[model samples]
Target: MERLINLNSKKSLTNEQRQAIYQRLLQESSNGKLRKGSISDIANSYAVCTKTISRIWGRGKLHVNEESMVDVSLKKSKSVGRKKKQINLGEVKGLPFHRRSNICSIANSIGVSKSTLHRRVQEGALRTHTNAVKPDLTEANKMARLEFCFSKINRSLSNNDSTFDDMFNVVHIDEKWFYLTKSSRRYYLVPGEDEPLRTCKSKKFITKFMFLAAVARPRFDASGNEIFSGKIGIFPFTTLEPAKRSSKNRVAGTLETKPILSVTKEVTRTWLIEKVLPAIRAKWPQGHTGPIFIQQDNAKPHININDSRFLEEASRDGFDIRLCFQPPNSPDLNVLDLGFFRAIQSLQEQESLGTIDELISAVQVSFERMGSRELNNVFLTLQMCMKEILKVRGGNNYQTPHIGKGKLERQGNLPLQIDIDENLINEVGSYLGL
Candidate 1:
């Protein structure tokens, strides 16, 4: 069926559409005039009268004769939209956070129109940010964070720009809890489809499992080939035991995988000595030789970096695998906490989990499913955060810097190491009395 275009009503052609028409007319023209019915054909295709097409062709030809760009844009001025209302950001900043917490409150405080402020927000001129309260840093914590970031820099000056290490040998380990289901979840459903109904013993008693994740900076060869994935493994804190008594869900003597409700220093040490150590030694890049560092946070349940048991297992098979602690109260310093854990958690949430076994499998699948490139990006972000840590003299008050790692990777130009300024190094070093 042939569709109809309303000719009486005004039709607005975008700049690209007008330019396309002009180029078509130029192609079909013999000298100045179009081929016999070229105008009619183009008009019918665009659903515009021949007159509109002729007018455009005339203006385009005039530009061709004058050797200028086609003036196909509407004659209307660019200032066609409503005049934007401007608010003094300085004044807004001066107001207390509570006063400018919402658009209505901000407008009332600054005496600006609420609708205008909302429009600005909608246009992204202004943003509504929800900032969680950051962990308070004591003077001691600041110094520790500064020293940790400083240790990351390679003082050898091997390159023109002194940069942080590639971190290929350092494995960042962290613990996270994955619940069977979120207290609240979002789902897309077909029209008239019934929403999913979920029941739980209690939201507080939701099935949860703790996991220890270990990841190193992924390795890439000279030609950008993947040498190592950097994914050592993610270990779940679980125990397989037989059900002592018969239950509605399971028969007696059936094997059940249960989560260890509480994580302790002893259990964590056991995992490091038994699971984490073996996985690292087996998966460590064959050609790469170095004192591999297992960087972990200073949690209460974590064993000391020099734990005798950990050292005993880590030193096997000519490998100098060692444990080290990142700065306390600083999650950004660890690559897993910086981004990898969050990435895997989001993927885990997408799976339908009903049992503890399902949760463990889901978390494991999410861990293995993540690409090495993403893990490398997290390590790069870790270096960028270190730079920010030094900038604030060890304060965690700045936003994480994004250097378009994905975009750079797609362009085959992702950086292996982020450079640090010498002045910044000296300034921070002197402050730390190093």
Candidate 2:
């Protein structure tokens, strides 16, 4: 006989803890029974009472005659924990969209804690959805989108497999604004470290510069060596001007970067003639001297590129670079909008840039830092989206498909293009009255 387990000290032992205690009891035992005070010794080691240890030992002994392995599964009733709060989904869904916009609001409406509602969401009992406003498409827009998808399908291919054109000659161009800093940023800081403070003149007035990015599909040689990186150029809309007045940061007469407030047709045309076309000429592969098509959205600046000014300049340098517009409101058709711009923007945001020049440099660096494989994947994703659009009869209301591009690439089996069903193409054409 030894000291008794303190009744005041008690805990609900887990199945693992009970099994551990039973093993300890057997170790302290001789032939068949636990030694004197072994129950108290094991219970005190596990921070449980003597009765809890005894119950575990009893369970282990009951299985001794029948089986060597003891089942230490918990015997507590299912009703031991707190009951799930009753949720009337009808009452919850009846709330206005704005009223139940967040977990807290929905929880209050259903008379539960925020954690309970969040738990329900995690357990799939409740779901969170996000809806974004889509561009209003008319009959013409849908037909145009359908026709565009039909055009991408390689009609020249001999097989019945509905594969998209390799699009090696097509370059995607899009305009996006690069801000100096994000409004809110998350940072991981060590405990007792002071939180960072970042301020600007105003968020609306934060230094931002627009860029026109152009990328073509990356090409690989027989050995998979990268031939052309497909990065044409990321041109910043800024003009260099000498500083009129001296500032604490810079001396007077220093050429300061002045961002172009508005990029009109003239500005876009100038970039094409001066910046974009030249970069394309220099970077385009010499062996494959084909007519490169510049695919762009139907923005006002991009419209009317058939004019002599654009055609005259584009036809220069022994390269025939033609301008073509994707269907209106069909961003999925363009590789840039499908995901590339966001990818480079995310990369650009990682840097701490201050001046307009620095921001421009960061954007260009990010554009270059992107591997050719990612750009190629975006093109494949563009084809996948076109396939999805055809499935929905040219509507943009389709989830983007995910084929494990990285996994496939790791296995050295990434396709240059995605193939679709031949029937989908015919059905889309019939739906569009083509």
Candidate 3:
């Protein structure tokens, strides 16, 4: 019968085929006599290519027994495949910055394949970063940030043992807008399941409500049991208005709640007096009686410290709540803006809401549902960022600090405060001509 030939010329021979060819060649050599076309005969019989048989026959000539033939018939060595191509990262780095913006462009400029560059990236030879635009910092802004970090240090400690205060007396307050629905969402579905259908009037015109959130560092008793959670309250800026005409969803003259689209000084003052101050009074721990500072950003619409309405309610119930502004254009100084708002926003986005009221309720729920431990960690992160600001001499060019907060918490060794470098502080002081 005619034997079938391997269609792929580059296919390597298996161990069994290699051994069979070796045995046949050994038999032909042992008799000290051979047919006129023995090598080609064996190649046609085994359906292997002639080139592979010639190479195996050469190796079989070195073996004298079946054991030697078996050893010689093993698979190819590790280095048998194609050689790996190397890209000179140093050469790539010499290119203009704009030319190295993407993998395809960089690969072309550096004379390397994009797939090889991608593999190098997966192997961590190259790194990818997302750049964000930071607010410009004036000289005055830098000085203010420096002073703020200095103020948090416990100067009462000996010059050698200075550390940051626990920040228990400071309450961070900020305003954020919560939308009723996101333009797009991702959901996991079973095979053959229908995709979720969502419709909206316009992506940009989705209904959103503004909220004022207040939080403080949580307090714990001697046993580490939480006595007072940091969450003071979250109040929405909204109002109820009567519908003028009958609609498909509601009858005429029905009171419909709507978000206050434009939050002005008057609205902010009202919420502080009516909602914020009351919540703080009711939730403030009884044992601690020191004055509390409500820290906010310097926005034009925010109420000033001397606002008549806020001053009246702030001093009542034996509580001294004072309003203080963080450094101008410095959102990083506020704990809420630094990370808390983003965390709660992620949680809020998980829920589905239809009306302005439902959106408000969802945000409030997310705020309350956040754990005290997370709030405390964010406060710690804020303090760490302040240290970074000081290190950079007030410039916002430092990397975010990450000291394994989760691992620390698991080991029950999470610190309530971070220590500031005394030498760094003195250097900053001299830099500012203090």
Candidate 4:
């Protein structure tokens, strides 16, 4: 029937003329093909019946060749709907709470419109605060630190009557501890991994650590800095894995196991006496005249200043080993504690070592790979910290010179042992802005 209609409709027209008429009709209806434009308008313009145009261009049904029917839904939408124009605003400057002004100021400063700024504020966009200026370390503090280090260095040389130029004769001593696991409360397991799998329990795994280490200052390179320095003395600690027991849970067929681990002060004392002292003696054979210092914490084991065996060992060697006790509980004052831990944590995160041997190897490699320069940087940072401390509390004899608690006690509640005079407190308070 369509073929008969087409033939009758083209009876007065040549094939080329008929094709041209059909193409002209298609061109007029092409725009309406994708949008809300009227098919009636297309039919009137192309001299075709509305019914014919509707039949050919029904929804998604077209008489046109497949190649010519490109999707123009987007173009149609843009042509019919209204659009917004963008404007340029200048740079914004002030904070919200401080300025307490309308969004227009921010919009002008930020090169955006007030509407945009208000919309962001409504959406909880926060303004950044400008930080106040900070004061540098005072000159008095700097000079005091310079004098402290130089005085110690000089006193060391004078006591021995050695040439002030011989830096090797001065042995700097420090001790550090390393923890096996990170000291954080949180632990995560991968999805689908079974919990409480067959693994060594940290407590029952005989987590006895390798010995504490003591190193002497290394000979300086031509650059006047310490090189691959110091002898390491490991005083292995004696810790024991206690028994493990499983407990029945109230829930049917459920059980939990807890392992017991234990350590003793005797173990520590013996390690220091039998291992550490002997190691120091072997390292510095020269009597007190020899360059040796057992610089360490005032810990009962290391300092053991009154221990007959430890003192005898030092005195016999003619090495006037000094037990320089830092203010108690001030781990921040000891760079090795913080810096070494940071390095250890960084190295451990990249690799997981399962066995004790592997972990030990990892630790040793981490320590060895950390260049002397890095160690010196740690020390330099420590030096700066020490200077800062002295600048704040130089030459003052507080009844309690050491601060064991994490925070300082209030002036009124502070014990007389603190020995903080009213004048000094006022001065220091002003220095710290109370």
RMSD of each: 4.9, 3.8, 7.2, 19.1
Runs of candidate 2 exceeding 4 Å displacement: 1-28, 35-53, 60-73, 90-96, 156-159, 222-224
Against the unseen true structure, what C-alpha lDDT does each candidate score? Answer: 0.86, 0.85, 0.83, 0.44
Instruction: Report the error of model 4 at residue 165, Å.
Output: 13
Pitting candidate 2 against candidate 3, the one with the higher lDDT is: 2
Clashing pairs in 3: none
Candidate that scores best on lDDT: 1
Most accurate candidate by TM-score: 2
Rate residue 299 of model 4 by lDDT.
57
How far residue 171's Cα lies from its native spot in candidate 2, in Å, is 0.4
Evaluate residue 284 in candidate 3 and report its C-alpha lDDT on the 0 to 100 scale: 84
Q: What is residue 142's positional error in candidate 4, in angstroms?
A: 18
What tens-digit string does per-residue lDDT give for candidate 4 at 272-353?
Answer: 5566556666665333354344444445545444656555655654445444444444444444563654674467445555
Query: What is the descending TM-score order?
Result: 2, 1, 3, 4
**Candidate 3 residue-wise lDDT at 339:** 90
Model 1 pairs in collision: none
Candidate 2 lDDT over 133-223, as tens digits, reads 6788888898788788888888536648658889999989999999999889999999999998999988878889999999999999878
RMSD of 3: 7.2
